[model samples]
Target: MQFETCHIPGLVIVTPKVFSDSRGFFFEAYNRKPFEEAGITANFVQDNQSQSSYGVIRGLHFQRNPFAQSKLVRVLQGTILDVGVDIREGSPTFGQHFSIELSAENKKQLFLPAGFAHGFSVLSETAIVAYKCDNYYSKESEGGIRYDDPELAIDWKIDPAKAIVSGKDLELPLLSESFANFTY
Candidate 1:
C-alpha cells in the first residue's frame, strides 16, 4: 500500500496493493497496523454508506469540534469526484480544497482529517460511497457550506443547473456565512 499526503496537512490519498486472478481481484482496503505505521492512527468508530445517481451532489459538510470526524472515504461501485476543503481557521491552507477521482476501477481512498468539510459528485450512472468516521455524529454540531458557494466555486462537473440537490443542501449557507462553529 502507498500513502500520499495531499497539499493540505493531514489529508492523504491511499493506494492499496491489488491482486488479480482469472476470476477477479482482491485488496486489503483497510488494515490498522499498516495505517498506524503510515502515521494515521485514528480510531474510526462508525461506518457510513450512501448511494446516489449521476449529478447528485451530497455535501460540503462537517461537524464541529467535539463531534468532528476524520473520514476515510472510497467508492464501492462506480465513479465520483470526491472533494475536501480545509476549513481549519488560521491554518495556512484555510479555505483551500482538493479533489480526486475515486472509482471501483481504480480503488483509491481518501483520508480527510477532522478539520475538513467533505463532499462528492457522482460521475457514473450511479455510485456507492462508503466511509469510516473517527467520531460519532452530532445533530447540533452538523454544519455545511453551500455546494455552489460563489467564493468556494466548487465544480461538480455536471451542469449546476442540471444537478440534483436536496432542499436542505440547496439552502445550506455559503461558506462565508456558515460554520462559525468550526475551530482553529
Candidate 2:
C-alpha cells in the first residue's frame, strides 16, 4: 500500500498495490503495520456502509470532540466524488476542502483524521460506500455544515438542479454559522 499526503494536514490518499491474473485480482484492504508506518495510526473500531444513486449527496458531517472520529472511506461497487473539509480551529487550511474520485476500478481510499467534515456525491447509477471509523457514533455529538455552503463553495460534480439531498442534510448550517471545537 502507498499513502500520499494531501495539501491539507492529516488527509491521506491510500493506494493499494493490486495483483491481478486472468482469474481475478486481490489486495490487502487494511494492514496495521504498513498504515502505521505511513503515519495513519487510527485504530478503526466500527464500519459503516451506505448505498446511493447518481445525483445523491450526503454530508459535510462530523462528530464533536470526545466523540470525534477518524475515517477511512472507499467505494466498493461504483463511483463517487468524496470530499473532506478542514474544520480544525487553528489549522492553516481551515475551511478549505479537498475532493477525489474513488471507484471500484481505482481501488483507492481516503483517510480523514478527526477534525474534518466529510461527505460524498454518487456519480454512478448506484454506489456502495463504506468507511471505517476510529470512534463509535454519537447522536449528541453530531455536527455538520451545509453541503452548498457558499463560503466553502464545493463543486459536487452533480448539477445542483438535479442533486438529491436529504432534508436533514439540507438543514445543516452554513460554514459561517458552523462551529468546530477541535483545534490544530
Number of the predicted model whose lDDT against the real structure is largest: 2
lDDT of 1 by residue, 14-126 (tens): 99999999989999999999999999999999999999999999988899878999999999999999999888888898888899999999999999988899999999999
Q: Which stretches of candidate 1 lie over 4 Å from their true place?
A: none
Model 2 has a clash total of 0
lDDT of 2 by residue, 1-184 (tens): 9999989989999999999999899999889999999988899999999999999999989999899999999989999999999999989999999999999999999999999999999999999999999999999999999999989999999999989999999999997898868899
Cα lDDT, all candidates:
0.91, 0.95
Q: What is candidate 1's local distance difference test score? A: 0.91
What clash pairs does model 1 have? none
Compared to the true structure, candidate 1 yields what TM-score? 0.96
Residue range with the least summed lDDT across 10 consecutive positions in model 2: 174-183
TM-score of each: 0.96, 0.99
